[model samples]
Target chain A: MPSFFTGFELAARLNAETRRRVAALARPPRCVALLDAANAGMAAYARRQQAFAGEAGIVLAPEPYPANPEAVMRRLAELAGDEEVDAVVTLYPLPAGVGALEAALALGAGKDVDGLHPENAGALALGAPARPPATAKACRLIAEELAGPLKGKEIVLVGASRIVGRPLASLLLDAEATVTITHAATRDLAAHTREADIVITAAGVPGLIGAGHLRDGATVLDVSINRGPHGLVGDVDVASLEGRSVTVTHVPDGVGPVTTACLLANIAEAAAGRAL
Target chain B: MPSFFTGFELAARLNAETRRRVAALARPPRCVALLDAANAGMAAYARRQQAFAGEAGIVLAPEPYPANPEAVMRRLAELAGDEEVDAVVTLYPLPAGVGALEAALALGAGKDVDGLHPENAGALALGAPARPPATAKACRLIAEELAGPLKGKEIVLVGASRIVGRPLASLLLDAEATVTITHAATRDLAAHTREADIVITAAGVPGLIGAGHLRDGATVLDVSINRGPHGLVGDVDVASLEGRSVTVTHVPDGVGPVTTACLLANIAEAAAGRAL
Candidate 1:
């Protein structure tokens, strides 16, 4: 069988390479704010961000906000306007009144490291020269690390959320990869997944991917984090994937840590202005 | 198996009822612009707009702009700035420079009845109340018309393009339906298709959905139009789908017509400032 973890490992390696490249460029240190909701799984994010801080400077401000996005946006806008902040990073499940996260980011576009702003996301989608979303950039880094080059590779994304699936697919397509995105309503999702040289899943459904659903030796990145008896289970069935040339980010260790690191990098880029 | 199309039709009827209730209030008609790409497809769109004009006093302005959206945006902005023009609708295959259609739409948000603008699209994705993209609205309308009430129906969308698949899924999800969006990279796509109550294909691949891929009574909507030897073909195999529980919008008569009509409606809403 071909290597299943090939893509994941490649992504890791590419992430490292990007860091090395950035280091060579003498980029400045950065910080990120991790917004936590009362319902958000913060413990795991804490551990993950700590590891990320070890790699680069990242601050976790676990301020819980109401689901009202307007309130959140007001807070975020205040944060963006602050002199101490370099860039802003947020976890989903935002409180009410904070719905304009993207618009808020636009207010601090240069200082927005996560690339969640509609402007950045839209720019990324159009393949324009713009700051790539941190998570999406990280996802691309992973793809580049596992695969020798992403050009012409068929990549299948198993979610279409703006933060991950849609932006990531746009990034991959911009990289010249044949990209496809599948969501809850997709018909024959497995068929599309089977054809991918790489698969990225962030659907938040634990064990949604199993051996039966994959092609031989396909790289799977389980971006979903399901907290239950298994602690942190990714979208993929890691146990069943044994001996299948698979390499996974072990939900606790994989994308979570990398995502924070990428956030810091994004902040650094925003502060630098030359990052785009 | 169970009849998916019938269920879809039932849901559509319910939606129609809801729409009827909403329409009972005397409100100004919405305006939607159909941005013509100067391609052959424009003629068909114009004819469809004529019929819509008769029904709701909707004004259809088919403006041909270069596929490049930057130039198109300049034109769109000029038109949108006009008091007579309520909403600016530009057809797809946007001119190269039209980098972010969403951004351009954002320029005319209050008037953007189709809701394809990035902010509007994002708002829809977040499940906030906003105008939806015309294609998505048409898809929802078709699904609702075919299905009685969309709640809890298994809908599979083939293709994950932002214009159609992603936004369509968001609309369907808001209507309390289960939606899955699949694209070229999905694995065992047929298995998913066979299980769906409704299938909407926008992959732009001609005849990608065939008889073998569908359930006995699945309702199919082909959102893709392929200029083939037969003139125009949809993503679904229409010939094979005939007489089954499947009711497809033929490439020429199906979604194409509805989308144009919806665009006009969007324009009217934009002009009246009632779409927000």
Candidate 2:
């Protein structure tokens, strides 16, 4: 049977370290704020950031998101000007008509803890210093945790969303790994997946990746969090990899926990005025 | 024998359209400015822009090259404030102390004809509307001119520079092609290249790609302009693809001319306050 790459365990370790780092900082308090636009789905995500912020000994400042784009931009501008705030993460699924690009740019790059701003994304695209999207960061950490060193490794990443595959490609490329990015238009998903030393899926399609798609013992990180009939599931059909020697993360416990941990670590870094 | 996908052909094709478009616009004359840093290579490049701007009925405003980053930023700010200038194209190889990112950001997205700004780059990354990087835009046009459509095709890009590979990846991805980005650290460049239906090399290493690295009928675009003993050459040894049925562009006439044309086209679009 494939050994589960214990995400919760690793997150716990990182979370404790984050707590220590935040504790050492001289302060009345360091703050990490979350801005949401009344989207219930985003509320769940905000809760996750809140939990991580608590672990890192940072204040979780939640903003009352307005309905209009201009109002939201005003709120973001105010937050950008706030000297007390160290980082700001916007909850997704914003009240429609407001794009992430505008929201991210408005948040200002340095306070953009989630790395949504183009400055950060552009920096990551060129393999420079900036906080990477947490899920993408978690995927890298999971691969390093399992594969040891990624240099020269062949990686097939399904989905090219800026939050995940696109940014992750730059990170992996910078780490000296050869990366192939596939998406809805990919002709033969399995053909590319089978050729990789590692396969990461963020397609948001239930049961998109399985045993046949991966080489024997390849590490897999699933970033798509979809609500399925069986409850919250990932892009991979984790059950289908059964009895193989593959190194994989358990569905719910895998990428999610690590992503939260990475966010907290990013907040800690941004507050310290240096990258961790 | 492979057909040479003519760069001058597409550029002339694009340039005529740009002329007609700019002529159609009612204007006291929109101006396009160039900011140079006194680099010899960039001087050659700036002259090309000057010629293009002159042809388009746009003024080629040249900022006196300065030796310092602060001076460049100051000039860029002045250009940004200019009411007459519709676009700004910074000459390449800016003084050593300045990075392209800061200069680009200072140029401001609306006036950045080269598409170097993070806003434009980020919009491109997400496949949203923004000025596409000119070299990347030319690469796409060349491919589309030959291949017709890119959907479901496998593309191997051999450089990840902001000017080429990175932007090209987003463009191809948005067009529904699978893209694999490789670089100097990529373990087996030929393995990836051999599997691709299209190969675009921007890696500056002269003769980095050869016939053996490509599929028999694959399309190749060499973006690297290396000055060799043979004068100027591209990343690929185009002579090696002699007998194949490949569709390709010539070294000097391949991607360079189209890049210049695309910049003019972008200027027209930005002047019109739209993305073409």
Candidate 3:
């Protein structure tokens, strides 16, 4: 049977570290969640994030985003200038007219905890000192924790989203891992995955991979969170890999918790950095 | 017989387009080549670039770089403030103390003609509208010119350089190609390259790849400019690929001219953009 890598233990460990760091800080780290509360989904996400922040001794303020692009930019600028705000994260699926890149630029490098700003993104890509996106960082952390050092490891990452796969590619490469970025346009996905020592899936498609798609004893990190009939599901078809020796992380109890913990850790870092 | 893809005709065509665009502008485009003239090799490169800029009816000004990081940043900021300067390109292999990312950040987004700025590099990585690094752009242009559309092709890029290989991976992904980025730490280079539809080599090591390393009929784009006993040489061993059906672009005549032409084109675009 495949050994499932649940994120609960790792999340707890990281949260503990984050809590200790926050306690040492002069003031609680204040993180602004710039999101559209009009969307029930985003509101729920913000509420969930706030719960996590409370546990970490961090203040998570959910600021409603304006629909207008200019107003959105101005709001971000305001947050950036606020000394009390240690970090600002513009939630995805931003109000229709507001652009992701523009919002990141307005949030500025100092407070953009999401690390979506081009400067941070470029720094990550260039192997410079910069905060990487929380989810991408979480993926790396999980992979490294489960497997050994990534140096020279063969990794095939599925899906090339700006938030995840794109940034993860650079991070993995910096770790000296040989990475192949495959997406929807990829012709033979399994051919690449089968040969990879580690397969990371962020395609958001349920039942995307099975035993046949992977080799014996390969480590899989699933980053996709899709709503299934039963509950929240991940990209991989966990049921299909039942009797294999593959090591994998399942959806709900896997990357999700760790991602939240990583975000909190980033907020703590951002707060600690301000004192420097 | 193998088909050799020379950058001459593509460069001439691009140069003609740039010249026409420059002629249509209110005044000749002004480009500043911020380089360390103290380095003889860089000085020769600047001269070559100047000659190309002249053909495109653009003024290429060579600026001597100060060794101090702060002074270098101030110089970049001054150039950014100059209304007369259309584009600014900070040449690589900068003087000892200055950092590449810091210099790129100081160059500012609007005038970064070579597209090394974080904003531009980020935009390119995110598949947003922005200028891409010229060398990466040149490689894509040459590849697309030879291979119809990159929609479903498999490309193996050797070397993970921030300037060329890193940026090229994103561009190739944008074109819908499955890109595998292998670098010095990659254990088995031939294992990846042997099955690739296209092999793009930017690794500076001479004769790093031979006919045995590539698939039959694979297209090779060499971006390295290493000084050989004979003269300039590329990463690919052309003699070893003599009788294959493979398509390739050699070092001196391949990516070099196209990169220069692309830089000139970017300068023209930057100059024209200012009017908007």
DockQ of 3: 0.66
Which portions of model 1 show Cα errors greater than 4 Å?
Answer: A1-75, A91-110, A121-137, A147-162, A165-218, A224-245, A274-276, B1-44, B61-74, B91-107, B114-116, B147-160, B169-197, B203-213, B225-245, B272-276
| DockQ head-to-head 2 vs 3, winner | 3
Per-prediction tally of clashes: 80, 0, 0
Ranking by TM-score: 3, 2, 1
**Which of candidates 2 and 3 is the stronger one according to TM-score?**
3
User: What is candidate 2's local distance difference test score?
Assistant: 0.79
Residue pairs in steric clash, candidate 2?
A: none
Candidate 1 lDDT over B187-248, as tens digits, reads: 56786688788888888888788888887767888777788986977787666655566666
Q: Write the per-residue lDDT of candidate 2 for residues A203-261, one digit (tens) a residue.
A: 99988998889888788887778998879888777788778888877777888889888
Query: What TM-score does the predicted chain A of each candidate obtain versus native chain A?
Result: 0.80, 0.92, 0.96
Error of 1 at B84 (Å): 3.9
Give the least accurate 10-residue stretch of model 2 chain A, judged by summed lDDT: A28-37
Alpha-carbon local distance difference test for all models? 0.63, 0.79, 0.88
TM-score of 2: 0.89
Q: Write the per-residue lDDT of candidate 2 for residues B1-276, one digit (tens) a residue.
A: 777766877888898988888887666235544456355676666666787778766667666566677887887788788777788776665666887878877878888877677767766765567788899999988888878799999999997676788888888887889999998878889988999899999998888888889888899898888999979888888788788888777777788889888888888887777322
lDDT of candidate 1 at residue B18, scale 0 to 100: 34
